[model samples]
Target chain A: MKSTEILNSLQVSLTIKRLCHQLIENHHNFSKSVLIGLQPNGIFLANRLKSNLEISIQDEVQTGSLDITFFRDDFRRKEKPLIPSVTNIDFSIENKKVILVDDVFFTGRTVRSALDAIMTFGRPLSVEFLTLIERRFVQNIPIKADYIGKSIDTIKEEKVSVLWKETNGKDQILLYSPT
Target chain B: MKELSTSHLLGIKDLTKNDIQIIFSTADSFKEVINRPIKKVPTLRDVTIANLFFENSTRTKLSFELAQKRLSADIINFSASSSSLNKGETLVDTANNILSMKVDMLIMRHPHSGAASFLANKTKTVIINAGDGTHEHPTQALLDTFSIREKLGSIKEKKVVLIGDIKHSRVALSNIFALQKLGAEVMVCGPTTLIPKYMSELGVKISHNIEKALKWCDVANMLRIQLERQQIQYFPSLREYTHQFQLNKTLLDKVDKPITILHPGPINRGVEITSEIADSEHSIILNQVENGVAVRMAIIYLLAGSINRV
Candidate 1:
């Protein structure tokens, strides 16, 4: 499939709307919950979720961003690594539930590192993962997302891409197979 | 590949080759930002940076403050004399209070060694060592290295002679580590009492006289004679020290090879170096001051972003 056509079929905005409804229904009892977005694209999605959730819940939600460049497990191979984005969660997460949001879930390494990076700040009551896309047969770790938009069966050599209107000038997901 | 997050920058010896390269490359980015029409960048906007200086400093403090402001970070200046510490509050208490204020980073200069490291352990905010009592000044060392690279093309195999008051100057100690790490041949020359005899243990050469040390050296770094050194009896008189250790026109004329002169300001002109030599063509003291802001901007930028992923 062409990149543009695959992206158009992804329906990220619709997936986000459905996920917000489900998250509110599941987490309604928690009063002091916060949402943390992984750096780059995850932060973009988290901000949208915060705005959408505010309309449904009638209360403000605290949002934070995390950069996992330094915390990555594989760091020896890259040349001139880019700086990570800002991580700004002002509230104490000690007893509050944290819903970690990201755009795509691949081998689960990013989410794994995010968990380790967040613990350095404070201990959250609990952390639940949410992602727009989940691929099949790629479980480097046993951890799974609590909220997944869609799970696609794919080969190991395929690449999954998420593009949003805020950053990439459109909302779409592209699956690229190695040549 | 990924960049390593160093917990603190306490000394040059603590940095690895990768760490030094990261610092230099980051400083290069800041150098580009400084040359633009609008010098400010939004990278550090809304980030609060605190400059806690327990020691008297004019130039270093000003350069740090300007660096933060140019990056659009909010700045809070706290001096020892007018601070709550003067009202009998402990250094830890003062630092805790500032950390309580939700400052993003703390750049400190104290009269005691390990003051910045102490603050780093007590708080979560990133701590930058501005200057600590005769211990190390990492940022100054970075700017000096940056200046040397800009002038000489490469620091590897270059000869650097650090002259005068080695024991009392933290800058000298920091330079010794920095130059050696960058592959420069470092030598310290001064009076026997002022120069630590065992500095050679750190892989540096020691010379009592400037004339022997200056031969074929690519750079001469003159350290200021701290006026307090006289009261402490490191030397008997300023006139005698100047006559013996000063870098003047006559000494510069005798050197067979062209050499760069460096001094961390504000200069004690006519004491360690003459006015004629300080303002001459070979002086990089002013370049060192100008690059001070860029080097510090790189440090604050990298450290602030190091916690998160882009």
Candidate 2:
């Protein structure tokens, strides 16, 4: 595998800080705006954003974890049963400005599925999306993101990995292409 | 990454520990889905299911129907009493007629053992055994075990006793297979005549004493006497049976440690278990019913996950 480092540890931290300030600038105090992390990867970014918001805004911020396994269009189309992560959204999203966060944006199908899955809890006033790495020119579905840290163009065979300190030893984003 | 080992869910014996875990984890997700305000999903939107009931059922039938509807699958219900089975049509003929209508899957409940297996052999569609006579009620067993795990966390190293008529119960048979496979120590306590002779070979403890069984178990899964399936009297009378084996509050209170209680429903009140015990916090009977829908959804979802549309 030929890997290209998209963002290193220090670069990743700076990008997250920028994203946190961007969120604070738009939704001041985050009283009406709720941050929701997509399950598995997005929660890590969501939590970091939440903690950063709490530190800067000097108040608690509400964030929830959402899983979209059941709402996926490829339910019966898969070779094996799709495993699901935990979905724990206790507070109602009704009329709240929902900021959906994810690790990387590739096909945009996950965003579409997340949009549908969030509707089950309550009707949000509006849904905005944020992602760490937004791959360019590879979207299979039409989805627009409100916040993006970095964007890149890659071949279909290449895979993008956003490693977190929780699972990985350090934080970094890399694109792996076939040699 | 785990898939069901077999295409058709004929019996618990046909499933491996990995398969059971797969179903349980899938059911865990469905549990979250059902708890939400909008409980339905569009996973099986394109598939059609035929619920064929060759026997009488209220709980199992409704549970399966609710599960299919939650997954957004189309269904056509058939009760054998109202169908052409009364007009001398065979079971195969009835199933074939349904399958010929382009039914994508079949959920069946029949009065004969191996009816689900027979249908699986004859049909190309996936068959989920919703209680075949004296054989297996795989989903019920799954939900029962699921309730135990939900209430008590894990089934491993736990003492689970199945209390009731074992000879005529498909639920008991399926539960035995499921509980044993999950590493729980199983004990079947009932009348000697009601206990099957082959249970000893299965390695579960057999006890004729319900009180002693209660003391020995961490979980008590009380089963109904199944009076309808009882062709001959296993015990002298209902009074005698109740006297010997009824799980009332007194029997429950006698246990030194906290014990989880489970009953697969259509529960015979005051017979196998008293109303007090059934309504107590220790009992997860209603949880078993609610989990029935979620667990069946998981079973159907996993079984139908890989089917290629024709």
> Chain A only: TM-score of every candidate?
0.90, 0.98
Q: Give i-RMS (Å) per prediction.
A: 12.7, 1.9
The numbered model that scores best in lDDT is 2
Report the CAPRI category for model 2.
Answer: medium
**Best-fitting candidate, scored by TM-score:** 2
lDDT of each: 0.81, 0.92
lDDT (0-100) at residue B27 of candidate 1? Answer: 76
Cα RMSD for candidates in order = 14.5, 1.3
Residue by residue across B131-164, what tens digits does model 2's lDDT show? 9999999999999999999998999989999999
- Candidate 1 CAPRI-style tier: incorrect
What tens-digit string does per-residue lDDT give for candidate 1 at B23-74? 7776765665565444666556657888998999998999999899877789
Model 2: residues with Cα > 4 Å off, grouped in runs: none
Candidate 2 structure quality by residue, lDDT tens digits, A71-123: 88887666667887889898989999999999999999999999999999989
Overall local distance difference test of candidate 2: 0.92
* Tens-digit per-residue lDDT, A50-137, candidate 1: 8888888888888888666545655323344455455566667787888999988888988988887677556788999998888877
